[model samples]
Target chain A: MSQKQIAGVTIDVNDEGYMTNHAQWNRDVAAALAKEEGIDLTEGHWKVLDFIDKDFKEKSAVPGMRRMNKVGGIETKELYSLFPNGPIKKATKIAGYPKPVSCV
Target chain B: MPDDDEIKKVSIIVSRGSLEGVYPGLIMANGARMKGIDANLFFTFFGLHAIVKKKMNNIKIGTVGNPALCVPTPMGVGMPTWLGAIPGMSWIATAMMKKEMEKIDIPPVGEFVEMIHDAGGKIYACKATVDMFKLAPQDFCPQVDKVLTVGEFYEMSAGAQIIFT
Candidate 1:
């Protein structure tokens, strides 16, 4: 199929082996995280999201907890409260930060 | 705006010297790790005390010259930093800071350092500051990754964001 449509999002796969639709996946993941974390989509939440987005834009790697705290000004206790799965891994996943090689 | 492919790296440097200063570095470094970015913290000067085992757990707030002191907040006004050096003043400031830390849930510096390491952030000691202050590895927490020169830190910090908390 030229395009696979899911939940009104389009997924394009090219013959060159590039797979699209990751953005859609990111959005879906982010939304799920918002709900799970009880995030109200306020400026504070956006601050964290924007930070993660910027980091992704720069490093091509998901930010770890240390970098997130440094850039986002979020506390470790707060992060732990927000993400029970451990802030280092869960927050990045929710923020749509690309998976780090060490994570798996 | 450049596409994702054009992105390079994100790095942060934290150097600060108050009870509050240590928090920012620790918090930031942990946050960076959460985002999957390479994070390094260079603890130098008074900031170095936060990593030292004996001093880390018992840091005294500098009430003298502390901007927070003058703030009309619930925490009460503090003395000046210069005054903090007074023989008895350091003890009072230390006591006050210890009390405040207790009131909050903030753990001791040693514990905080462990948390940073557990979360995968890199910690380095400043060699020059160590020599200047007559500190050795034994003087610091065991979690320290290395004692490095400022030049070494800069070499590692290249192309990464360097922040002074």
Candidate 2:
């Protein structure tokens, strides 16, 4: 498979700027995750999703929870609250990013 | 090009009881599975409680000197880990952690374990630690795959990156 295919999600950019094939699905998943954790998705949520996607793309590994916490400047407690199901999995899924290989 | 056979393995060793300590293992293990890598979690010592008897998601916070618990000041004030052992502190700390987790979208321990299982990651209980702590299999979360000795765990973690969180 080519790099694009291996990456799983398709990226498309138009007049509206970059949009991913799984954008709608990601939003839906993020909304569900947010509901489960009883938090609203603010700008902070997008920031984290962006970070996870970028990091995973570059490193080919999911950012460890601590790295995410430190880079996001989010406390572990607060980060857990946002990702109650765990950030790397739930958040990546919601962000339409591939799941990291190290997760399970 | 990255060779198909060159896939890296990641193994995590969990040994603490605080939400901070426990969640990292769970999240990393699950993330590894998601990425199609070989991943495993070996729960030992106090970390065993995270996967034990439905108590994984119920981990209390270490309110003592946990840097994460501090409020923002001109500098900043954080909870010290030392306070985690104070009498009656675990209860309050756990409550705070639960509340914090609820505020975010993370699931409780039970559900998180379910998620890990669903993602195809392996979970093991440390046999020696279990015996040392007098814990039975029934004391562990139902999702555990087996009770393994440290030797067995090391064997599984061998040839992989071992992370102690």
Candidate 3:
């Protein structure tokens, strides 16, 4: 594990830059992370991040992409349109969860 | 070919009918979509069974010539391929694989296709194969976006990584 500062807040992250401690996550940190990823957070982006955060809290894992589209009402195209790089892995990381176990 | 970093899409050609043959393509396509890479699954030849409405659910693991099936032991013994050729053995292997997949929460073939479709992966069947089998467009699962010729597949696959499974 290594430590880095985002938005002037220091937190532990793995070699791949995924946050190691979910507790260090906050809305501000997420915004900073999104900015670093070249994403401008919008209401739709927040909808996905919020859904992922809530679902991860309850299920202890980020829901699969299919479940995200079906239940979150975010279709696959829309998801890609929002994330535009790595939707599941990137979104879950920004949402302050570990990398999804099933995402390739 | 586009440089590795320039790959914006992935076109997976599924050319086999067996569950073992098709699952890798499905998994890869789904993974690509999850990663926000455009994904297209092109089913050709017997791979059409993967998207055919009545046959997708019935994909069997190819037991004959399969060298991977083995009885677990300290010595790592494998079942002989001849035994695999025995009638009904494929079903057993399919059942075992299905059970293992269920334990890991992997969806079945049909449900997996549906999931991929919902995730915005494009599914295509080869037009020549479809015409050869006399399969109408409606004969395929609703997820299939089109029946395309090889040239069209190549056109759609431009600037994409084309993987064969």
- Write down the worst ten-residue block by lDDT for model 1 chain B: B5-14
lDDT per residue for candidate 1 within A1-104, as digits (tens), equals 25544335564534321233346555555665466556544555566666777877887766654455556687655655455434545555456444444421
- Residue B140 in model 3: lDDT: 91
Q: Give lDDT tens digits, candidate 3, residues B128-153.
A: 99999999877899999999999999
The DockQ of each candidate is 0.09, 0.12, 0.48
Best by DockQ: 3
Residue lDDT tens for model 2, B44-158: 8999888877566567766676556553321456646575557987677567666666545455777677666655667888888889988876787777999998788888887
lDDT for each residue of candidate 1 in B21-99, tens digit (9 for 90 to 100): 6776776665565554567888888888888888887666556665555323327675455654567664665566666
- Model 3 residue B53 CA deviation (Å) reads 0.5
Best by lDDT: 3
Sort the predicted structures by DockQ, highest score first. 3, 2, 1
Q: Note each model's CA RMSD in angstroms.
A: 11.7, 11.8, 3.5
DockQ of 3: 0.48
Off by over 4 Å in 2: A1-104, B4-7, B72-76, B79-89
Tens digits of per-residue lDDT for model 3 on A25-88? Answer: 9998999998888888899999999999888888887887667766788776678778876788
The lDDT, on a scale of 0 to 1, for candidate 2 is 0.66
